[model samples]
Target: MSLQVPRNGKVCVIGSGVAGLTFSYLLNQLRPDVHIDIYEKQERSGGWLNSHHREVNGSKVMLERGPRTLRGKSDGSIVMIDIMRRLGQLSQVQYVGKKSQANRQFLLNGQGRLVEVPKNWTQFAKFVMDPISGGLVRGMAHDLLHCKRLDRKTYEDESVGQLLARRFGSTEIGDRIISGIYHGIYAGDMNEMSSLHTGRRFVEDEMKYGSFVRGMFSGLGAKPSEILSGELMEYNRSIGGQTQHNWTEFARRVKQSAMLGFAGGLEQYPLALRAYLEKQQQVRLRLGQAVASVLPGTGQNVVVNGVHYDHVRSTLNPSAMAAIFPEIQGLQHGDFKSVSVYIMNVYVPGTNLIRDAIAGFGYLVPQRSSQGDGLLGVIFDSVVERNYLNWQTQLPRHQDDCTKMTLMVGGHYLNKGLHLDLHKCLGHVSNHLGVDLAAYNPVTQNLLARDGIPVFDVGFDKKAARVVEECTRLYAGHVTLGGVGFARGPGVPDVVMHELAAVLHA
Candidate 1:
């Protein structure tokens, strides 16, 4: 897949999110002679990564609209850490402590109360015996020992729910555990999403060894980042001389159980990337300009916005990309699925909440828990970053003592619409936390209207592969597709590795 791009070759990147910017940044560094143009339809270049800070009294209140932190175990974390070091912004990166990673998270039990997730064998046994988690734990155990072999000649796609039911004795495990975690990550429906695409490693493991447990045991010693990239070690080695060693140090840090974020916020990474690109003579950033369509140019060039380019990498969603290049197969409607989620930022009395709340990262609500309006989860921003709320307070009486949280809602409803009201979300949190916000005197609230999270449904493999092949053929090897929407895996690191591969292979 390696191609010798000509000197001074022109490459147009559509979208300036982490994926597009990372592609441009790495490409500029690798082939300094290449001309790059990054076009973003929105005025801001960071895509959905929005962070806001306000000064109350003398203290600072921070709110993250999207992607609060990057998991240390992910390849995306390693990539971002590497980029931070290269950009001279590593010092600005802050990591969450062991408590955030190692401590037990909560799940809303059938009794409408938060319950600590079991950690050790004793806790596991108790959790399994409890009525709330008994069925799920027993079902998962049954599958681990007696699941049937999934023999297939071609890539067979199935939903997380179907796979669990087929392999395990019951689909309760899927409806409870898988759905709870994935809903927060993808905002996807368990019955509709493709297990092959979303949980490929576990699925592939089961396919290879006839049991997912066996596959997990086989790779238990490997670093999570290696597993996340599906083994991109050789590709990393091909890019830079010290890539492997740098990644090794990152893996060590991950083992310490750290979830990383920018001191300012995730938005800083993209802002830094933009600033670096502006200094490059061959780089051009087109903000607030949308690409109407992409067409083929004469010979080997690709055409967009009436200009010819040697290569074009699209980080747009499947539907958006299909609208621009209608000729590409399998990018049409129904091939790709996305769900919109409403995010509410709430501020509660910090000192009391921190001392009284669950004190870990946050809590996830399983579908079986039967919560109102099907809320996905709530993130304890202040708890995750303990220093986020430490500052002087503006009010003479009220010091800087408020816990900040981001409430995520409406992931279960794919077709049905969800009516999101601030008071409603607050009411849910108030009841769940057993705290009355009215007593806090002044409660601050910010809302992120909507953001899309992609879903890979059954039969998505053939269609996704077809789309990639068609794009490559139509552009004559000049167009490479990548992003959270286009990649095999989810999250930031998967997309980073995807574009990294394109530039390296190119």
Candidate 2:
């Protein structure tokens, strides 16, 4: 039934980010009897999902300071739909269809020109001729012809750069393609990022099939059930049959779409979660209340800020966790690094600023082209959802003439100690888009020291494993990791999957 059901067990969830809130939401659903207390250091929920709403003249404009969209193809998107359907916020859901022009993603070439990433072999053949592809075609040939499997016994883990370099016979492919993707997503370095955590599938594929090319061919006939975890498959099944939610129908709606977002913005997702959790008598969201301490309590219970709980579910990063609970031996001063990103949300009304008015998702600044401006990427926020009317309102997302986008710059991974202010950064993006952004005044531009994007260095999975092993040895069963810090990736789906799995294990 509802989340208001009473329960005897008590649980504490730290950090009211996506992971903490989603964990609490799932907790009430699976075990409604357990009373939950969510602790957030910030004054609101939705961790980095901040949407700045502004009404200029007649049209409403939304600018995102953090994460903005969810890919429809990810299992996390389905999890979001399940939560949204329950929150009565499905009406706020928006879609970017697969065939939409906004789906075209670009990577900056060495000459600082935008080149559309090849979608097919015909395009790839043409694309590789350009120097920006970094001998991608030649690399693919090398992998197909000369690649050899790694020794499982010795190759426990490596950097994503190492993996790509090993297979492609050079680091060029990783530097050009994979680096940009990771930068855009994690604000991290491909050379330092863990292959065990990110490229494990490729590692396994190589070991099994000799190369990624052969691996891809071998997996051509795999079904959804085979690709997705049993837990996710079961969750989808459980929600699909729920006539009220009609998740099956919802999935059908977005399955063909490229990405999904909220009507106002992504902030709606976390706001909805907090609103729903607030209605439940069994849940308490302690926003603006930081957890000062976490220690082992009597029996199998853990104490959070002096309050005893049956279990402690932490969404805090490893460093934050180490600070709070020093007893966790292996968690001390993690090898992982944090990155500072400069996010500038630009909203220019009645003007299509893109070069030649090109309609696409936006271009990413890869490793080779990352310097000078520190522009990691640009999200064509308005362009991506073009032609898609507002949810039920049947109006364009913004004024027909308005264009919205976010510029990322000065990430520590690439430009450490680089503090390129919004003023200095405008010209770089302007040169790329062929617009004088310096002349147009915009809203919301600043540097955010976000802890959400954790830079997982090589051997991170091993370190994480050792931390878990130490926790199990030290705390017995009092503490559990669940959030961006512990998840395989910081994506919404990864967070939800890891947290829910921890709940089941706990």
Candidate 3:
């Protein structure tokens, strides 16, 4: 929630990345009189939303080097849409239809073969016969018919794997689908990630209604924004003072789409934020400036790089936070491990690389088989995105319709030593795409982001709370942490929600 500035407030925001920029923008809105400064070590404002444009074989293609799209029906997404519409860029909103071919999802089984996670009758028939679906039907049946609902009061936190085993009454579902889904989303082990932090409703469904399928009919559903704080809701209302579009209703409509993004790319959000925030008279963006420390000031203020401010909000990860404040390292009670990701975006002009042209969103490799070959997932970029960043002035759709995919490699599997075997990784990708690496020549860009995605391990919520408590004490209540690997989730929407809460709380 951006606040109405009470007076001449000064706040220093660390990291001009998504979280930082978001925090500044919200705070500026709520407290217009407050002078805000954003410090980013990198020259760019957006954190992992790099959209690179290139002309490949006479066709213009936009390659998203990082996160390309946002999930629909999220609290953060609604807020994001409101911000986008207010930015006067609502015309740029692009939606992939709910009935789009991109709605189909795949999972790589233990045999390392991609199979459609059945949706329609034909695919369901094939899935029933596939080895990957060996005991899935029985497991689902057990969940719907045999499993007994746990008392809501007696329920405790458990890994998603444990939930599947207990609720579904089989391990095959976990092995075949759960593992692949979590690996794609978290780049972490399904057996290790917490069910509550990842999907509380999923766990609660089995606890309260005996089964997930049954819970859909239980009439206890909640909207994504229903859980948001009243402060945030008020902030939304404040922002919506005179706008015609009801963003909540708009977001509900958007939730019907398979996915959504800007016509240019996800980077459009942050870059646009940078440009607009720069225009604000009360805002100052300190790009390319590294913060040495954020120490408590003499009286009623925080000092960031020798400048005293009423507040200093940091948007860096845990390790980055610990770097500037070593005292925070003592608060760690459990692992907050993060994984590095090696992203390879490929643009194969005029030639469809996927065998049989099996068009779907993408497939994810399960954690059980991801160690030696850590290809977390592949994005069918072209299936979801049909236009380049400058599509307004770019080549025709057919000319840009070549294979566009992104290979995300080296997460939990290779996070140990942080190694990058580009050729080896590309070989795995090309193999999945039904091509020989030696013969395939595609325009590609490789990017390695160290400790990019955080693993939401079991008990991560408790451990993160303790860390937050300790950090609050260390900073003498002058600093706050609002970034990935904290209490909030690691998704783009989560980051936005976290900062909105921070702004309201402060």
RMSD of each: 4.3, 3.4, 3.8
Write candidate 1's Cα lDDT for 175-214 as tens digits: 6666777777777777887887877776887778878767
The better candidate by TM-score, 1 or 3, is: 1
User: Between which residue pairs do clashes occur in model 1?
Assistant: 57-394, 76-493, 350-401, 350-402, 350-403
Estimate every model's Cα lDDT from 0 to 1.
0.73, 0.75, 0.73
Best model number under lDDT: 2
Ranking under lDDT, best-scoring first?
A: 2, 3, 1
The digit string of per-residue lDDT tens for model 3 on 214-328 reads 8865653543443444644665776544333454456566566556688778988888788889999999998899888777668778778888888778788775665566557
Best by TM-score: 2
For each candidate, give its TM-score against the true structure. Answer: 0.89, 0.91, 0.87
lDDT for model 3 comes to 0.73
Candidate 2 collision pairs = 7-33
Where model 1 places Cα greater than 4 Å from the true spot, the runs are: 1-4, 99-103, 152-155, 212-247, 355-357, 387-400, 412-414, 441-451
Clashes of each: 5, 1, 8
